[model samples]
Target chain A: MRNIIVTGGSRGLGLGIAERLATDGFQVIAIARSQTEVFDAAAQRVKAAGRGALQFHAADLADIEAIPALVKAIRKEFGALYGLVNNAGLGTGGLLSGMNDAAMAQLLRLNIHSPIALTKYVTRTMMTQKGGRIVNISSIVASNGFNALSVYSATKAALVGFTKSLARELGPLEITVNAVAPGFVDTELTSGLGEAGYDKIVRRSALRRMAEVEDVGSAVAFLFSDGARNITGTVVTVDAGNTA
Target chain B: MTSRMADNTEPSVRSTILDEIHRIAALHNKQLAPLTDALPLMESGLDSLCVAVLVASLDDALELDPFAEDENLAFPVTLGDFIQLYENAAA
Candidate 1:
């Protein structure tokens, strides 16, 4: 039973990823600040089937300084960590010029600093084990620009670079790192856009439909599978050809 | 070595540092000669990535990272200097 940590796994795309991995027989430690009723139900269903285990770990990932101790505690309880899904992030969409400095700082802290700090400690365990998988949840907007998402897009773009360089650095240890770039996933993160906003996005996509949370989940699952053992340092786009 | 020993009485810190270096070297498939206090880390065949893994691994084992403590501290050039950083910080 491999231990996989899925940050922000209480809901949204993170929940989808957690459920998918758990169903695939991976012991998932879902880290989120709070647990949702939906998340609890899903964990129950997954565990009842005896497919895999889902354990929730409440944490405020934005507290970057506490990450090392957090990682240490996770490892102490769960043993060697086999995978990490750096999916916890804040989607702060706003015009850069009007964005408050404090808001920008908070956005950067959660979206950028948290994951990197989390990864730093997690990779130590991976390095010691000589193998692991890392999947970063990036955004399609990282490559394709969007209105009012300048800061959000930049943060996601940073992950792309982080994924590539980290893949290179940890490659010698047989640890593979990759990013999953999803486009217009229908989750709480995008609910703020409302129906008309989604309609516009759906029409723009080649598939004429927004990508599902499960689509991103499956992509992440693939990266962790044996089939993707040789695939690293690249972005696997799950955007229904939105960029095409 | 004197600088490291001066800060702390424990002799095991030196051995722990050596062990981690060798462990990380093996993980990265880098062959290293038996280390001497004056051996240049770069010449020991461990690249920057390997050295990074070593520092991280040491921090995990020893629970402190001297380099991370002070941004202004010069990077250790020799094996002894590297161990001394940990010792001084631990002290």
Candidate 2:
């Protein structure tokens, strides 16, 4: 079975993606600082159902310098990484003026630097193996923009460029790179909006409902599937037409 | 620690660069002409992406990238100059 790495897989959308991919029969190695009970349960579900296995590894992705070693160690544990989900990121929302220097620095480090550095090492393995998939978890706010998310949006927007350029760079090796831009999903990441805020968003969406974490997960899984082999250098927006 | 040996001799460093050029070429399905010290990297059949992979892999193997530390360093054009850059950095 092909091995995949899902960063931030302890909870939220990352865990959802891990569960979905494991259920779809890809050995998923979920990298997070700590494993959650919810993540453990999902892993158990996949295993008990005789689906692909879901396992966990610990890493602080914010430390960009340590990423090369981290990728090396993970590759040693799980042979020939077939896919990477750059899902670990901070959604610290704040207006650009009020955001302190430290907060801005922290946001850039985790949101932008970590994924790019991680991809650098991961793609080495992929380039050698001659085929792989990379799905970067982007936010719908990246394109449409949102209140109090100027810096966050910029970081996510950077991933769109990262995804497109990397897709072109690695295309010759048969590696596919894509991004999934999800609208406000029902995760803790969006819980800050609370029920009323989500309801307001739901009313605005053409679907008249907020997207579930599973929807984002399915989009990522689809990209890793054979059906998306030819799909590269594009952003797969999963916002349920909220942007539409 | 493995790179410590390359610090002892420039030839060993050159050998590492040559081996990596071959490995990267094969991985990308590019056919490289026989390597020589005078061969320009551009003529080696490895495109920019492959050259990037080669540089990154060498940095990992040697644990030192002179180019990363010095922005003003002249970009190496020949296969020999690339190996020398790493050897000098290791020294």
Chain B TM-score, all predictions listed: 0.84, 0.83
> Model 2, A140-197: lDDT tens per residue?
9889969999999999999999999999889988999999999999888888997788
True-contact fraction per candidate equals: 0.55, 0.27
Model 2 chain A scores worst on lDDT over the 10 consecutive residues at: A121-130
Every candidate's DockQ is 0.52, 0.35
**Winner by TM-score:** 1
Chain A TM per candidate, in order of listing = 0.99, 0.98
Off by more than 4 A, model 2: B1-16, B26-31, B56-75, B85-91
Question: How does residue B71 of candidate 1 score in lDDT?
Answer: 78
Best by lDDT: 1
Task: Report lDDT (Cα) of residue A151, candidate 2.
Answer: 93
User: Positional deviation of A6 in candidate 1, in angstroms?
Assistant: 1.0
Error of 1 at A138 (Å): 0.6
lDDT of each: 0.89, 0.88
Model 2 whole-model lDDT (C-alpha atoms): 0.88
